[model samples]
Target: MQKIIVGVLVATFSVNVLAWGQLGHRVTGAIAQQHLTAQAQAVVTALLPNEDLAEASTYPDEMRSSPEEFWQKEAGPFHYVTVPEGQTYAQVGAPEQGDGISALKMFTATMKDSKASQADKQLALRFIVHIIGDLHQPLHAGNGTDRGGNDVKVNFFWQDSNLHRVWDSELLGQRELSYTEWTARLNRKISQQDISAWSDIDPQVWVSESVKIRDEIYPQEEKISWDYLYNHLPQVQERLKMGGIRIATYLNALFK
Candidate 1:
């Protein structure tokens, strides 16, 4: 049954953990190298190990019986996951907010489930961590239909892919920078208060914030391709930076 859904989902639109890693490398780099609380730094560090794993851990089938079931697995050590919509927190029992909130909830739940296998819980935790950052991305939250624009086909700087996939991996990976190199460039301009104040917050707020950003992302057009890229790459980078900083803030609160 799970396989069926995954298959269907894959057919409709497929996003793997590698997508997360590619985005995270840039986002995480932006989060680190900034002055933050020790707790926040630690949370970012914990997420660091899982960064590259996003490349291979696209195993949503193993996590739960359905998308809702996947939400139930939200516990902690890491805090976020890509939850399918139409499922509530009470129904799913995981983190109830957006990617970060949902991921955080899953992370907390995994820590409490002694009956769960270590590997199962850890995989869940890794997603929780990764997804929080994903949620902060306005495009990841999407426009309530395309699973965050994954289905919105377009030519991203001439590459043929959907907007969601473009945002998921292509744009960030385009420059061929390591996670550290990307963050280094971003962190240079961050202020001390931005680092301190950005730490410690709820993921729900982040989700709401992204939803607002979503409207600005998509215009009423059949295609959002290279032309859109020329116009919006700056917005794209800004959102990625926002996601990284916001993710660092949420994790700091959790660990602290």
Candidate 2:
């Protein structure tokens, strides 16, 4: 029983480390779905007949509990990349086991391969949706020092939490909005200029942007509250919007 409890805790921590929380992922997916070209939308429909991208976006993280080796081992590192301060991802490069950008490139090739099995394509599409969102979460582009801020403990609104969890969910949760509501609110703020600027699908550009934001986000105080939220929410919202646009841009290019 004690072993089982420990396993559960480990599994939970692994999941927490790998995602943008369900709401954030779903919001990005929904926004992406809206921006997808008709051809891309048709392809997505063929690949995922029953579920929307929002549902599909959470697939990788949701599978973290699986006993399979792929989920248990290989896939965890696909959610984030680490670049030490002052170094670019190009300088650090992907670890031999691979990182988010490497996994994304592999999956994208699978998605574009006409001979690939439907199961494989489905996995690729879901992962593409997810990794785009994951890369947008600034912490996912860790500084290679603090486990993406998971080690930085803080009291968030008097609740014991770490900086990673606060960024991953707590700050967004404070809005009291569902994923769709968040999507709706964010989508309105996206303009043609914003879309044009964010439409670049280069993962390196995404990582660089994230690394810059990640550096700026570390909190000074151990106690976090409205001031923190008020300061960072714009960055959070912008990242989500960019993630969504880039997902659409990528898929539209893929299926075009």
Candidate 3:
């Protein structure tokens, strides 16, 4: 019975473990690229001569399928931070294996270390871009229950899904827009004031914002459809925009 129960729980929560789908991450990256300071842009161009931020934004998730030990076992926790109900991230701290907050610190140090190898800096840069996008997805800052809502089954647009997937991809996917199209539309909505307000580079602040959003987004019913989309789409857009802005702000400060 114990084995059976464990298997069932694993199956229930394993689907769609990624935070933002490919398109969403790309959208955040593109937006960030547009916002980058000239120095940051020059450094990014030197580091990623072949790929743009949009392409780099998806590298960590794309590598999740690698047979290597780092991707297979070690890198999983870097994608999210767990904050249980009524508890702050400061109160809970990172687990033994570490989490998104620790990963950000590690990679940020790598980016700044003058002696770090180019390849190592490149890897860190890729993760920084990707992880910033991940932290923006409310579900990535899990509530320490339900595997970030993966266990809460639902029907998204009449198709079987879960609360995590709904926030991770389905909400953004429903619009059928390419990442560039999404970036174009979202960029227009960002005002100077919005940029100023969302420029904070602290990962903890991002996690806190995500946890607050995560708390309010759980569905009241298992049948999620247009109403859910209509209600939460703005929040989704806001997060993506903020993610992009912060990524730029962070890199600018780092490269400065």
Candidate 2 residue-wise lDDT at 74:
77
Worst 10 residues of 2 by lDDT: 5-14
lDDT for each residue of candidate 2 in 8-57, tens digit (9 for 90 to 100)? 43344345685669999999999999999999999999989999999999
Off by over 4 Å in 2: 1-15
TM-score for all models, in order of appearance: 0.63, 0.94, 0.94
Positional deviation of residue 128's Cα in model 3 after best superposition, in angstroms: 0.3
Candidate 2 contains a number of clashing pairs equal to 0
| Candidate 1, 146-254: lDDT as tens digits | 6557667776555577666666666667778776666676666567676566554666566666666666666466555566666666766665566566555654555
Which residue pairs collide in model 3, if any? Answer: none
Ranking by TM-score: 3, 2, 1
- Alpha-carbon lDDT of model 2: 0.89
Cα deviation of 227 in candidate 1 (Å)? 4.9
Q: In order, what lDDT does every prediction score?
A: 0.52, 0.89, 0.88
Which pairs, if any, clash in model 2? none
- Candidate 3 structure quality by residue, lDDT tens digits, 1-256: 8557534433333335787889889999999999999999999999999999999999999897889998866788788888988889999898766778899999999998999999999999999999999999998888766887887899999899989888888899999999999999999999999999987898999999999999999889999898999999999999999999998999999998
Candidate with better lDDT, 2 vs 3: 2
Which candidate would rank higher by lDDT, 1 or 3? 3
> Which run of 10 residues does model 1 get worst, by summed lDDT?
74-83
